[model samples]
Target: MKRISLFLLLSLLLGATVLYSQNPETNLRVVSVSPNAASLGTFGMIPTSNYVGQASLSIPVYEIDLDGKKFPITLSYHTDGTRVAQEATWVGLGWTLQAGGCVISVFGSNAKIYSANYYDIKGRVVKTVRSNLLGGYDITSTTYTF
Candidate 1:
C-alpha cells in the first residue's frame, strides 16, 4: 500500500510538472525590440512634453507575445534613459500599464477601470483587483509581468 501511494504521488507530480512546462502562456517572450521608436504615451494617456520628452526617439517599442496574442509595448524612459513605464494597447481601444516590471493597471475603451494592482514598497505586486460584469470585484494574489 505504501509503495502504491508513493508511486501515485510521484506520477501526479511528474505529470503536473510536464503540463506546467508545456504551457505557452507561462512563457512570455519579446518578439522584437525597436530602439528609438515613437512614443505611444503612458497608459492610454496622451503624450505630453513631460512624459515623452521632445524627441521622437524617446520611447522604445517592444513586441511581446502574451498567450499567443501579440502586443506592441512602448517603453518610456526617464531623463537618465532608464525605463520608467510601459504601455500597450489591448484589443483595439483598451490599454494596459506596466510599471516597475509588473502590470499595474488596465483600462477599457470608455475609460473604465478593468483591473488594478497593489504593490509593496519593494515594487512587488501584492494583489490584483479586477472588476467583473456582475458589478463586483475579484481579488487575486497572482501577478503577471514581462
Candidate 2:
C-alpha cells in the first residue's frame, strides 16, 4: 500500500510540473533590444543603431546627433509567429551606456517575457553608467498585457 501511494504521488507531481512548464497557451509577449553599430554603416548614417532577432523582428535605433532633432521610435509585437523569443538593446554615445530591452520566451503554446527595459531620452545631459552624454533616460522594466 505504501509503495503504491508513493508511486501515485510522484506520478501526479511529475504531470503537474510538465503541464506548468509546457503550458499549451499563454498570453505574454516579450520584447528586447540589441545595438548593432553596423546599422550606422549600413544606413549610411554615422550614428544609427539597429537590432535584429532570430524571429524576424528588427529594431532600428536612431540617435539624435549634431542636427539636434529627436526622432520618435515605435515598437510593435505580433502573436502569430511560431517563435517569439527576442533580445534588443538601444545604445548611443558621447559616452557609453547599456540596458536591457524587451525579451520573450515561448513554450509550445504559451509565452512569457522574462526581462525588459526601456529608455526615455530627455534633457540636455544624459547620464549613463560611465559618463554624462548629450541626452539620456533611466532604464526600467515595465509590464504589459498580451
Where does the lowest 10-residue lDDT sum fall in candidate 2? 92-101
Highest-scoring model, TM-score: 1
- Tens-digit lDDT track of model 2 for 43-121: 2222232343222233545544447865534332222222243223244221112122233322222222223222223
Listed per candidate, the RMSD to the true structure in angstroms reads: 17.3, 19.2
lDDT of 2 at 17: 64
- lDDT of the candidates, in the order given: 0.37, 0.34
- The TM-score of candidate 2 is 0.17
Q: What is the lDDT for 93 in model 2?
A: 21
Q: Which residue pairs in candidate 1 collide? A: none
The C-alpha stretches of model 2 lying farther than 4 A from their native spots are 21-146
TM-score of each: 0.18, 0.17
